[model samples]
Target: MNFTLHQLQVFLKVSETKSITKAAEELFLTQPAVSIQLKNFQDQFDIPLTEVVGRQLYVTDFGQEIAFAAQAIIDQVNAINYKLAAYKGQLSGRLKIASVSTGKYVIPFFLSGFLRGNPQIELKLDVTNKAQVVRSLVDNEIDFALVSILPDKVPVHAVPLMENRLVLVAGRDFQPPLGVSGIEIFQYITLIYRESGSGTRLAMEGFLNDHKVPIKKMLVLTSNEAVKQAVMAGLGCSIMPVIGIKNELKQGDLKVIEVKGLPICTYWNLIYLKSKRLSPVAEAFLSYLDREKNTVIEQNFQ
Candidate 1:
């Protein structure tokens, strides 16, 4: 059976996303185009590569094996391209990074200079929840994982990027009930929190448990931005990183409340497994960080 490289790429994407529409969006192609290519690719095989049921797509067991081979071919093609770029005295390769959702605000600053300098480099930055980020890091699918709270039982090296300061924030016009301070404020107000798997939620839980703040009424949101919006809408107050809410604070949409022992601090760390090997692109990025991170920190976070 013969298939074009584009077919393999399309099949790989479809396998990853499990949705023709999403694969089309990522590939910048029309839905009909993706569907046509996918059908063309599947025609090469006798057995079904994919199955549709109740508006859901599922890859057949045989399709998973084909996808594995397809990924290998794609990697080989990428390696050849990188080698050719090197022959031309140009740095070019794919650099994949996974960052927790809240880390979206921080990763770009560290990457902007390096990415701008290496114009040929392809950067895949996946902004996702902490659990997915950690899973990708553990599976060796990503070159780096940006997070504030490190995963347990994972032996990884962490390079501290910046301090993550989490503060208690409410709408600008929000006022705590009289005599509410410290743990008492939590009792008086509905507390907002990120989902359970989030690094921010883990940190917030640790702080609250350590301080023995009994959260009575709680509202859970899926992301930091959601929690911020909820707080701004006067739904509840939340513990949020200053990095994410800086603009709202400046715009007077939100205000931080001074609670004793509040403003929990942790360092945002760029982490990688100790046993994992770094690619040339990854090595170059690490060197660049070592050389210029101080200036980046001072200019951005400081």
Candidate 2:
């Protein structure tokens, strides 16, 4: 069977997006054109590459193998292009970075300069929960995983960029009930928490457990922004990282509730698999992070 690299590229793009229309748009081709190429590629094979079920594209078992092989070829070709650019001391290639959702506050500041400096590099960022970010790291899907809490089971290298300070916060109208004990405070107010997979949630629970304070009658929100909004509406008090609340705190839309043993501190890390080799772009990014992390955090967080 003979097929062009273009066919494989289209197939991989389709696999990635799970939508032919999206793949066509990404490849700058019309939907009909993409469909024609897909048909031609299928004509060369007996097994089905993909199927549609319930309005969603699902790759067949054989299609997965084909996609994997296609990805390998694409990666090798990209590696060649990166090496060619490297000979000229330029950076060009795909850089996929995964981070926990809360990283939105910090990663952009850390990346702005590096991204501006390496304009040729194509950047893809995945912002999700901590579990997903760590899974991406372990699966070798991302070049860097920016996370606050590292997975204990995963053997990886973690570079600490800055401190993640978790502080108790409430709506402007609420007063800090820093009286009696931590347990007593929990008894008086409803606690708001980030969803289960969140790094912030994990840190909060760990801190509470260490102090033997039990959480009950709590509200859980999927994202930090949502939680902030909920707290600003005076739904409940929450433990949130200072990095995410700077603007709110400054504007007095939200205020920190000084609890007796609060402001749990943790490190934000730029993590990657220890066994996976870094590409030139990834290596350059690591160096750039090392050189600029302190200054960037100081300028943004300090």
Q: Kindly list the per-residue Cα lDDT of model 2 for residues 1-302, writing each as its tens digit.
A: 99989999999889888999999988999999898888888889899999999999888899889999999998898789877887788888888999899898888998899989987787888899998988888888899999998888898898998988999888999864555444467766789988888999999999888888866679988999999999999999999999898999999999886667788989889888989899887998989988998889778787
| TM-scores of all predicted structures | 0.92, 0.79
Task: Mark the regions of model 1 whose C-alpha exceeds 4 Å error after superposition.
Answer: none
Give the per-residue Cα lDDT of candidate 1 at 227.
94
> CA RMSD for every model?
1.9, 3.9
Q: How far is 113's C-alpha from truth in model 2 (Å)? A: 1.6
- Clashes (backbone N, CA, C under 3 Å), per candidate, total 0, 0
Write one digit per residue (lDDT tens) for candidate 1, span 180-295: 77668888889999997999899889999998888889999998888998999999999999999999999999999888877899999999999989988999999989988999
Residue 59 of model 1 has an lDDT of 96
Which numbered prediction scores highest in TM-score against the true structure?
Answer: 1
Question: How high a TM-score does candidate 2 get?
Answer: 0.79
Candidate with maximal lDDT? 1
Positional deviation of residue 157's Cα in model 2 after best superposition, in angstroms: 2.9
